[model samples]
Target chain A: MAVRLYAASVLALDDCLLSVMDIPGVLDALVMDHLSGTVMASGGRGEAERSAPALGETLRVTMDALAGATHRGTVRIDDLIVIADDGYHLLHPVEMPFDGPLVIYVRLDLGRANLALARHQLSSITGRLRG
Target chain B: MAAVHTLLTGLAREHATGSLNVPPAGKAYLREGRIAHLECPRTPSVERLLTAHGRAGGYSRAELEFCVAGAVLDAAYFLLPAELPAARPKFRPGECPRPDTRLEFELAWLVGECARRRAQLAQIWSSAELDDVPVTPAARLPGHRATVSALEWEILLSSDRVATPAELADRLGQPAYSVLLAVRRLAAAGLLVAPLMPRRRGRALDRAVPPALPQSDPNVLAAVKRALEELE
Candidate 1:
């Protein structure tokens, strides 16, 4: 009701963010444009926002490097993971048909987060977000 | 910007609240004079700060304020005035918009942010001709040697030529700002036939894009620096 009054159209992608937030161990999550690193939407802590610039650049550089290294015209990445002593940081690249690839990144506490479940949920969120 | 925008900005600066309606453009919603919301039927809502200025967690309060500030400022640049011939587009004493809803907010920060964003957009691609123009993908990959980002690839594949960036954004359910950036980047890359003049009419709000948030622990100080830097 408030949504109709406030925002003519309430953002639906926010649902996707909420779904990811419900996953256990997920501390922070954000989605950024793959090319310009523009923040699209997010939930959790948003600790990953600043890294968006570097993250988007990393996606570009890595895509180029991998394509060249493997000698392929196109290269597809499933996801990128960084393991830390304190927690786990995951970057999932979504092949959204609209703006190309938007990266959905999440940070998880190593102690509280189940890597398998978290990855599974992240993948699920990405799929649902695109559909 | 248009005259209706100036009138609307004045209402915001004076701490007035309501919806400043523009016949053909869009509406600006002010909360206690601080622009609380914006509605342009033809343009995508900067619903969540999706500008090219920053990158960060999109869920923090302060960050959210910054996002709000950006949305207000960016809209002012395009809608708050008739045309910005002077380098600095400020809110001079003039006509403003009369809105139906009102809230409380200081417009000082909003004013400054507008200037900053204006300078920033100029630095990005330095042209607005293509900003509102309809865009179409190139016939074939030029030289077939173009190096593009993932987002660019998506935009290229989706460009049907008839859709403007705003329309494309609506179709893809992506932020209009990101689509705006993608269009600029693609044009800069020489991958599109720009000057495809024609502003798309208003679209229904069936598929609205999502907002931006950052990923961090809830226990931190909200490292405002990271988010601001990416956007600033």
Candidate 2:
């Protein structure tokens, strides 16, 4: 994608979060700040709000680990897909201007989810959010 | 706070509407027994962070509120925890925090998040001792070069050697957790000098906290190393 400075989105993040959750196999979605684990918006059955800090901590550690392995100053991770006891927990990180490294956490149903298509669609949504 | 954790929760339970103040430290604004906003002088505001990082271009109201939500949690991580000897913050009921940014949330949930954050810090370093003790960057970039994230770069650039990670956070107008993460990461990467010599034994000890080795897992490191080589 060509880099163009996007005019900040006027869309309410809550609505954006809700729209993301409507995707097939997407059980829930929460937009959270990675730095402080603050839940900006949640659209799940509702684990996203509570797991904000833990998830943020996870992202911090993961970033450190990735940087170590890559020997890079910073690691730009688009998403992290973790398999859980019930299904899949997909964390999509969106870089926002006002705040974040905002992460969009999505719970996907393994049985019905298309990982590639979902990721592509998520990329699209995040792209629209970028500044 | 008489009961510390319970005080805030209990206040919320009773539908108390006021700001919990920890003077010279931070404040938590409660609206009708629920957490609405938080501000810490030690922890920079979202506006400050956005301005510092040059990411604040034209923030809309929703975007700013989104930032405030993150700011509230970021401050909560430092201010919410049931106090420790290292950074003991005693709160007394005080006036409401001004310029209220209304976003209602349960205090209990925030406390839970604080617990997880405490554990997360331990996961980074066995203890919070290094957090208060000043850290000095290596005279030379260990390997004559270094890779640092935006936060890490700010940390390295502003590391006075006299100011600890907490102090640096305040100085740089960044979140305490983010700065601490950078501090630990720098230590892990061997880009920072260890804070071994304790100047003061005032409660928080400077114990030997081993840095997480990048090469600990041969398999993962090897794959990444190979990928880097391939790119080269």
The most accurate candidate by TM-score is 2
Q: Tell me the docking grade of candidate 2.
A: incorrect
lDDT of each: 0.54, 0.62
lDDT per residue (tens digit) for residues A12-94 in model 1? 34555667777898777775546435454566545565566676666667777777677676788887777988578788887
DockQ of each: 0.07, 0.16
lDDT of 1 by residue, B50-158 (tens): 3322333443332333244334434554455433333433332332332211222234444443464455456567776666555777777677577766556767777
List candidate 2 stretches off by more than 4 Å: A1-13, A35-75, A79-90, A107-117, A127-131, B1-4, B54-57, B82-96, B140-148, B195-232
List TM-scores for all candidates, in order. Answer: 0.51, 0.68
Q: Which pairs of residues collide in candidate 2?
A: A73-B147, A73-B148
